[model samples]
Target: MFLNHGSFGACPAPVFEAYQRFQRELERQPVEFLALERRLPELLDAARERLAAYVGASPANLAFTTNASSALNAVARSLDLGPGDEVLLGDAEYGGMQILWAYVAERTGATLVHRPFAELAPGPRTRVVFCSHVEWTSGRVNDVAALCRLAREAGALSIVDGAHAPGQIDLDLEALGADVYTGNCHKWLCNLRPSAFLYARPEVQDMIEPLVISWDFHAPSFPERHRWQGTINPCAYLTTPAAIDFQAKHDWPTVRRRCHDLLAAAELGLEPLTDDYVQMRGFRLEHPDPPELKRRLYEEHRIEVPVFESAQGWVLRVSVQGYNDEADLEALRVALAAEL
Candidate 1:
């Protein structure tokens, strides 16, 4: 049984079928789908509209990227940072994102400050406050709206990395009030791999330029400039509407509630390090070798989960999804008892 949905989410059968259909259509008429097409824009717009409604953002304010990393790169590279400027971030931020910001800091002479906790009070030199809505490592959910407000009060831009929040929680981008927000559709929205979005408040949209200078470089609108990045397959982006439809048909909210309950129940005996997660729970492990424990669990019990060392301690993270059941949890408990 699979329990690592946080690492890579599994697509529903209907969504996968829809993704295949889009891919087949693209293969049938490559030129029409990619270049010489009159309908491509409409198709993209419709997909974006559906996604925007799902995320509670204006269609004009949202743009599709391959994933959260790409979307974040677009935001990071576009910002005019210089020496003496500070970019505040949390220690719980994704390691890949930390690398991206480090590179940005090196290039622009900006200082990158890492806070031990998610909460931050930006200083005078702080240009941007970057943090995650749902921390990947600890599964801690932060008060993102309040963080954004703090950034605004300090006269700094707020960039929220919401890669883990989309389907796990109800998000209203407008209500959040972050200047820039990036999220992955594949992680929780059940969309195809590499499907994600970036939202910039209308006032700040012009501040973000496309990562790749493409045909839309001269486009008048912000989304138009960033949407079409060269002649790449946009099937994943096109299939998002179908993914949303599939979630609606399956009553994903109830499914999520059930998953949360499962996670809570599973974490009962082994109290998790943090109780802030919706579907994923993280518990401390006294075991010295987390990787070995993970491997043994999979090899011996056919259980799949994530166990790794973090700043907090060695952690074993269990993810509960709609497909998971009590049997899966029981198997994991037995395996962990044997290995750890």
Candidate 2:
């Protein structure tokens, strides 16, 4: 039973076929598929248009990256920081991103503050107000739209880490009003691995500097500056439309509701971190070793879920996708009951 779609999503058969089709085409003629501007550029532009429509953003403002981390790093690095500047983030952010901010603060003379979302008050020196739309650790949903309003009031830029938001919740980036936002298509969207997009508001697009000084950097459009970082595969990127179409064709909204109800029915006998979660739920675990519990769930029970220690404590995070059903959650409950 797989219950960890949030960690890395499971792509559907049809979408994976489209992704593979693109890869095979790339191999057929590397120069024409990759190097030719008319071929690769037009294809990427069309893909970006479809994704932008889905996320509620313009094509010129969205840029593709391997994952949300890289997308956020691009935004994090582009910001001009100094000794007195500060970058504020939530205490319950993704672990990898916590390390990312630490690295940035060490390199530049700036302070990184971690506080609860409600307590995030942008001060004079607060250059960036960073947060996650759906927290990775506690599975709590943050009101990032309100956070953006606060940031604007304080004259600070809002950057949202929306890694788990795309398919799990409806997104309207323009209305969400985050100065910068990045989301993972590979997560809730059920796209291929390592597909994500970073959105910078038109007003702030000029503020973001290109991470890679490649051949496409000189393009007049700011978003196009981020294109063609290397010879890295664009097959996953090309399948965005197919991924979106897959969800739409399956009546995903109804499926999501069913999964959410199924997950809610699981009797884990553990305290929930929050009641605001959707298809995924985070439970407080008191096990002596969280990693050991994770290993036992997988090794002994043949169940797949994420059990790790975070600032929040030993967290047992269970995710429910359209593929998940009552049996999967029941198996997890049984396995967890035995361990506890």
Clashes of each: 0, 0
1-340: candidate 2 lDDT, tens digit per residue? 9999999868999999999899899888888988745599888889999999999998888998889988888878887887988999998899998988888898898899989988998998898899989989877888999989999999999999999999999999999999999999999999998799999999998887767777877788866888868678888889999999999999989988998888778899988888888878899999887788899999999999998888888899999999888889999989988999
Worst 10 residues of 1 by lDDT: 266-275
The TM-scores of all predictions, comma-separated, are 0.96, 0.98
Work out candidate 2's RMSD over C-alphas: 1.0
**What are the per-residue Cα lDDT tens digits for candidate 1 across 1-340?**
8999988978888888988888888889877777725667878889999999999999999999999999999999899999999999987788889999999999999999988655588999999999999888777788899989999999999999999888888899999999999999988887888799999998899889899997888888777888778877788898899888888899999999999888787733455877778887788788777787788888878988888876667778888888889889988877777775
- The lDDT per prediction is 0.86, 0.89
Model 2 shows how many backbone clashes? 0
Model 1 RMSD to the real structure?
1.5
